[model samples]
Target chain A: MSQDQYFIAVDWGSTRLRAFLCKHSLNANIELVARNNGPGVTKVSDSFEKTLFDCIEPWTTEYGRLPIYLAGQIGSSIGWRETEYLPCPISPEQVASKCLIFEELGHEISILPGLSCLLPNQHYDLMRGEELQVLGWLNQRPENRKGQHLICLPGTHTKWVFVNNGQIIMFKTAMTGELYDILVNHSILIQNKTASFDQAAFDQGAKFTLQSEAGSFVHGLFSVRSKQLFSQITGQQSTSYLSGLLIGSDVRAAINANEWNVDSLDKIALIGAPHLSKSFARVLELEGYKTEICKLTQTTLAGFSSVFRATESSLITTS
Target chain B: MSQDQYFIAVDWGSTRLRAFLCKHSLNANIELVARNNGPGVTKVSDSFEKTLFDCIEPWTTEYGRLPIYLAGQIGSSIGWRETEYLPCPISPEQVASKCLIFEELGHEISILPGLSCLLPNQHYDLMRGEELQVLGWLNQRPENRKGQHLICLPGTHTKWVFVNNGQIIMFKTAMTGELYDILVNHSILIQNKTASFDQAAFDQGAKFTLQSEAGSFVHGLFSVRSKQLFSQITGQQSTSYLSGLLIGSDVRAAINANEWNVDSLDKIALIGAPHLSKSFARVLELEGYKTEICKLTQTTLAGFSSVFRATESSLITTS
Candidate 1:
């Protein structure tokens, strides 16, 4: 075997699959040397080995036979193989063991286990790829881990995780992104032509939703177009208003559930696209919550790096 | 034809078509003489006459070319030949004037005009079939018509109407039913085994929703099943919790936009399926609002009756 070290990390999600190639050495920087798109584990046939090999064909010349660490839905029931979830308030070791191992391509491949929490006599929240992101966030700011933090990872099913002292205490999932899509695409609220986030509308919607009754958000949505057509509320603003109503209601519910403390506003980090994350952060700020935005790609990548490092360390110790 | 003195009213909604025949006497006892399903105006082909004729076939024989009044989407651009919408805070004359007349199968048919509210510098809110229901409710309870009332008609797109002095001041729509359907049937939240609503879960969801931040409800839904499975929360309760979250959020939004004073709860009437209306009313009651259940079928029938009576009186006077 060559002395040169090679490592790989993958971020597999519901709709998209991404892989990163890295060479690990003392004082060496992790690089994204290869990338490909194919039928994710969820979409392809059961030939998992063939699928992985086909996707990584281009990188094989340089680092195809590297130890690979995978994260995200690849461990879901429909993914490469079903990996058991680690109960919440877990450590790195728990996640590592729960990881499912796949042997092929003359290299070791492991899928990271998702984190989950079972609140006594209540509902549980589960997360997959995001654990790597959390791990990344923690790895980047180890000292900041002293206090509790709420990380908002926005997507089809956004996740709001509560982490305390390096442990994921609990988490919650919201269908904010999906709802937005449905309302804009499938329902009657499709008047707005632009795909961009409407900040003004979002702010208004968020404000309205925050103060509204527990079950009143839907009724308020009709006004989005009506306000634009008659009330002279601009379509863009109406869109923003809608965003506000949904996100504001979501935040309000999370707050009410006592998932996190209001005083910890400074600890809220939004990990998603800049515009959306900023919009949510703005709403939080208006409500007197200190908020921060974490670049989505960077956070995800960092998360993958952390897992890769951990896996490499384990392999070295064992070897 | 024998002068039996019978009047016919049709309540044509998005999904269903229903007709009622009433004897033109003092009591004017209304009976559901005929019913048929066809494409709603929105979905109907240009062969509109065929669809309409099919639905009214059962009642037409008994009524013998009676004065027929139509309400709902029949007044839309696609329904029964484009009827104009009457601006809100309107009277019976306004609704009558906006009616579009169509001759069909030797019967004088007049479709009721929908209501529209155009606020200065804003888009307008419009309603079709439900206006008849509103009129019926107003006519039935003249004594209780002095103050402001919020009438909730829950369905595919739930409507919240604010009425004062027998005129609809404003209204809003929530796609709650549609959202519920999508979540339960299409979204990732779908679980194999069906679950019933649990009051405890609903109450918790409602309470949590009432306090949630804007836009969090969409994100919060995914945890329902997972919460149920791993956390010992029953699936049924999780479903209820989701319902509570959605419905509670909708109600909250309506209350906020209308700036409704909950101190006078008795003025709110919920119209829908008995169970759903009651559930919504319960949520309102918990919020210290006075709520009453409005039988959805009766209200729709009464609205149709009121319009039918109005149409008949006009024909008699004109002839």
Candidate 2:
């Protein structure tokens, strides 16, 4: 008989729902079984329960009442259930302990709450999908749960998370990707003719972030437009230059972070897509930091597993 | 004999053409007789001649064979005709001397060439309408042109110009207003529920730009969103905070400018709308700089007058 059982991890976000069906081995190794995606909370709106089951029914029919764990926007107020955000300096175990349980599909459903940090100004900084990735990074290797580590998750909203001894201490989010998107797509800074990447232009932009006299990013962005008008850079090249400038600014901000110095962040773990990570990796390398890339899905699944282990044994039962 | 003659001054830009009908007194002062506006280059596109005539027909009919002087984007490639940018350090006289002439409506029409400054990086920073305003500020008082002065014109794109001895030395453009518009409208930053201005929130935003360690303007902009999400700042307050942040960054960047020290720019001439100028003046005052708001239409008319004086009598006479 197979010593493998099925479990589902859903990283439900604002725009999309990504569900992974995995095989849990007797030795605690989780292997991907199948992956399914559906419309996120945005598209399904008030019909999330219906939409989620509609996409994951095939896996449930084959696996027969497997335990399901959810994270990210799914737990947001606009999502399936409004779970309260757990204040920071909390551990992965605490996150798992607080996962809200819902009775549906004749099975147990656990939803993870996001992490929140109160700034000195009393403004709260938060992350929905990233908390899992942080936990997953640690779960990938128990040794990773030790010591201090800088974790970067690059996406539409790039986050620089600080963790110490397996607990998420605090972190800041940079709207680097979103600004790049809006400027390139909407602002006159770039007339992006093609979506192709240019390493040189991006490098130039990255270099600009290092120049303090170049003015604040608000002042610096005009260089793209000026360069284009002066023929210093082409329309096609502006895209990469702009990307480098924004990403470089993000890195610069992280460097200016109070949590740790540059040497302390010599090696940082990055959880993101390979393509996006490559751009960030280039900037980090230039800024004298070593980056280690971890697949987002792997970290996400690993995160769910870590939370599962933290929960009561009585909560999840064998089928 | 009547000591006044009517003329038309049009501040033509990409989006709008604002024409001022002024009665020129014998003493060189221009009084507003009437005002007219029409769709700019973008709206009329290839039908520039038709649009130009349509908007100016009323003025032409009232003031027979009026000498029409134009400044700004109407001289660009997308405008009525393509006029090359006059390289900087060139005087108002030179701009007027270089004005492109066209015969229309049995009268002479003059289009002033925009000013272009080649940066140290060889990136050309160009200005269309602001050039006239700078010269007009100088023209307002010939003594004002005897020394170096800083001039700021706030708009969709803010321009900071340095004038020395009746000539524009150099200028830099910041996309602050445009960035604010895009973020509030398109980006994830603000869900601004109302259009009202909150001075306190704006002050807070402006204050953020002064923190060097807060990282670049790119890093700071994210706080608006965080503040909104945390409920530390209301959606209504975000619009003002964002404005303050962007304007503050502009001031900070200007303070950090290499052109001249902050003390050297104690009193900068500002040419913009009253409402926009008030916001800029507030930030400047907070930063220990004095701002003098000049009427835009006045500077424009005075600029046209300066340009007109520079033009040869033979060129402006009816054919």
Candidate 3:
């Protein structure tokens, strides 16, 4: 703990609100000081301020009036203040400028705007928190910014983004995680199965999906039940099989899109939870795409700090 | 209506236990006399006998130990009697011959065995109640025994069957309706919506799915939310879009399998609720396939009667 607390960073989404007390070290790195998670936007309802303040109470009190930068659903139409989405190819400057700035209880805070894009894939798409995380990830790798790169942020809504020359060109989302959650929890196929990870089952599911006769996701899904019927799959392994099936489908679609050269798309960075990232990493590798696993929180913090610094510099110049 | 009461046919399943008091018409028809639905096997738990008796008390008291023909989950491992599965290429006789026979309260009861098969698509498959319904449909049209027909029984689990000359050669199940239920009821995607049938939305969803980038069910699902985001699809239309996307995907996969000649597949039979049957009919029609819609309950009665008659004829010969 050589460095002191610098600022407060929050990644607030629909299900949960997480806050990180960070330190801007001498080497210009985001060192984590402390963390707190509270009810997310959906649960907080009218008590958004109460929940946000309740969790960051200790940190806020210690830092006095330090700046707080937030991202994700906190700026959604249902969040504390709704912010307009800046269309891609959006730079970090566009995001910072569009951030909704407001004050509460003698405190200064800004919520970043989300990104919307007209995908080349004949569909329109948008992402809230993950876009900022992508920005955070890009800010850390300036050397690799000159060329085109593909980044996948695996989550409830897995995003497949095309980044060209430091700007997000376009992105599309695949509802893999959310679908997996519903199928395992509410579906008759695997509702009785637990969420325990089984590597073999998962690998089998992914492999089956990849080799699936072209364009048959709905059919492959029903295999979960049939596999169980033929005693090829057990209840415990059903969940993993589902996970592999969904993740493998998601990856296969991206590969088929011809957006990424699987053989040459070296190091498609995975920025998400370690467990989820590893699952995605395995599936991508099996399909001949190299992957670099990165922590979600780190990238989110880096993104928040990057925008906060840009705003800070502008303020200094204006004064 | 001209026929007199003859036998009791029960379509016993996981969630609903339906008993039909049928009449053996002189014209070789099974006329409906009365019907009752009790707590399904899943809800009744181990007290299956109590629930069944409670619902059909009036009929049993009047008929005095009539023969009961049971099908579906009533004969599953969790049902009152665990019956064996008749392998595919099975005829009505095979199903009737393997019926789990027993006596209860001076009453003779027969539970028809389910169908299991290794699909031509290389997946193991099984069906309980739907197989019985298919048998009923086939029994009504003896002429259909000469050729192959594609039959779709749409419901919670939609079944696409390939029947050849009075035998069910093979079939595949798509979790379309069930997936639709969970998504509209539980998934964060569109959980707050009602099940109002939106004709336009459904048509749009089904059509959109038909044109979806090959092999990407997971990606297209996320578009339901994106379409809403882009204001191209409203909340009222979300359910239909989901329905269309799923049904379209299900139908497309079957068509692309190289197993069926879509242009010459001639008159695909649809057996299910009128509303859902029509939805599948519309989608299949849009893809240039002919669909013959039939009532599920009617087909179930015909199927049960066909088997019951076979058993009755054998009893007389044995005596």
Candidate 4:
């Protein structure tokens, strides 16, 4: 029974931290038993031990001797400790050794090493929890995982990842959410105070960029605010125009960059908060791209579970 | 002495108010005789009479009386009384309206009617003082002004004006400066500590937006601060990157629009503060365009002078 015990999984990010306790069966139905707030290693200032114990207290009380698995920034140098990155094209066995083990309060905790990809002479790119999510996605849909896919994980810094054969090849980061916050809170475009997504503004701004002359974004931005202030553009519609300008310009740039082939629209998957993910999917659809929205929480859960299972399997094989 | 007075030009913008006493002789020597503050109508809370006198105080003290001419927003509804717009294809004589009479002040102030271009069923575009600069450029070198020209006047709200055949055709406005201020001061891009321009960062940011795959600008903005906070990007370079992003993007948009293509690059003129003007000119030059930096103060003086002379000529002809 002790050997058959389940493992805990954690997903800690910049703003929020989540933990899950799961028992993996042979059928791979991971049952969630306990959950708690682990001290977000990134957010709290106290000792790492205190933070970790605080989060694990409830789970530990419920399931006294469960081994813990952690992902995300907890593996960062500043988080629990300096856990080195696992080089890309890594196997499940390599990932298990990459997990750092720490014994505390009569319980064992292990943090997963993030994945990194290096180009010939360029600096390497790294991903923490996201890699696990990709792994989880692949585990669940193994048949759909063979081809090159563009995975857009949209948040503060939206990451557009190119995954080939279950490994991240290359990725670009976009600060879309941050920009939206700044423009809305600080820029003169604050005339549109509506918090809800202004679809009209999004459509107008999007269309404007699509039909825009080669380099008209600069002028178009001014019009977004000025038209509203001068009453030439309605407040509600201005948001759409602004959105269009941003999204349209982005799309235009992306199209020009050949980041995704024009002919390969079906290979895009969006992972983000519902609204933004849906919005981007809609825009891609309008541009004749077949898009899919990957459920964010589900991906996180699956990712953590897969990492945990992979680690347990490796331990069993080593024993 | 009265006949010796050649020209009177006034620069009335959102911030400062000034009047120039110029000798309309062979050399066209321009002298700044009077300057004042908070009379820009938008800033002034006092009576228009008081604001005008405050500005005229220096000239009234020095020359007692002179043929006074004015340009800029002073001719707007909130200005020296409402002056209507003069439709485009208008020559110097056609656009010059009668000076507004202030019986109590005992001086004739002829406020120039700003030039406007009607877009048939579409809304009209208007300009006040810049028309004079365009006219001055035209008048100063009639031979060099045969084809299409794009004059970029950078300020709070930068104007990109398209002029063809001595007639103002169309113009677009950009809030480049304002955006820069907001981003630097209020947005997440705030350096917290003052930092100078980082050419490398600027170049990187510029290149980022210039790329075909550059998605929405909002997405790119987060990297400005995030890179700094995460120590991935240097603090000093962030400002430069931001400046480059905004300016570069603006330039890209302007170039893309290609609103003023006259089959060659010899006709584009950039007018603004020396540094910003030069920055813009440099970027345009890189894009295989001929760009000239028009000294902003000098251009404003010339613009004011041109409008003054045109108004005086009209007064004389009408009288």
Which of the numbered candidates is closest to the native, going by highest lDDT?
3
The sequence of per-residue lDDT tens digits that candidate 2 reaches over residues A266-307 is 588888988788899899999778999899888888887777
Error at B115, model 1, angstroms: 2.6
Model 3 interface RMSD over true interface Cα atoms? 1.4
Ranking by DockQ: 3, 2, 1, 4
Q: Which has the greatest TM-score? A: 2
All-Cα superposition RMSD per candidate: 4.3, 2.8, 2.9, 4.4
True contacts kept of each: 0.64, 0.67, 0.75, 0.57
Error of 3 at A295 (Å): 2.0
lDDT of 2: 0.81
Candidate 3 per-residue lDDT, tens place, B84-167, comes to: 877888887777888889988777989888888886656777888888878888898877676888888998888888888898
Enumerate the candidates' DockQ scores in order.
0.45, 0.57, 0.62, 0.42
iRMS values in order, in angstroms? Answer: 4.1, 2.4, 1.4, 4.6
Query: Model 3 segments beyond 4 Å from truth?
Result: A1-5, A25-27, A45-47, A191-195, A258-264, A316-319, B1-5, B25-27
Give, for candidate 4 chain B, the lowest lDDT window spanning 10 residues: B117-126
Worst 10 residues of 3 chain A by lDDT: A257-266
Q: Pick the candidate with the highest DockQ.
A: 3
lDDT of 4 by residue, B139-160 (tens): 6567535667778877766777
lDDT for every model?
A: 0.69, 0.81, 0.83, 0.66
State the weakest 10-residue window (summed lDDT) of model 2 chain A: A310-319
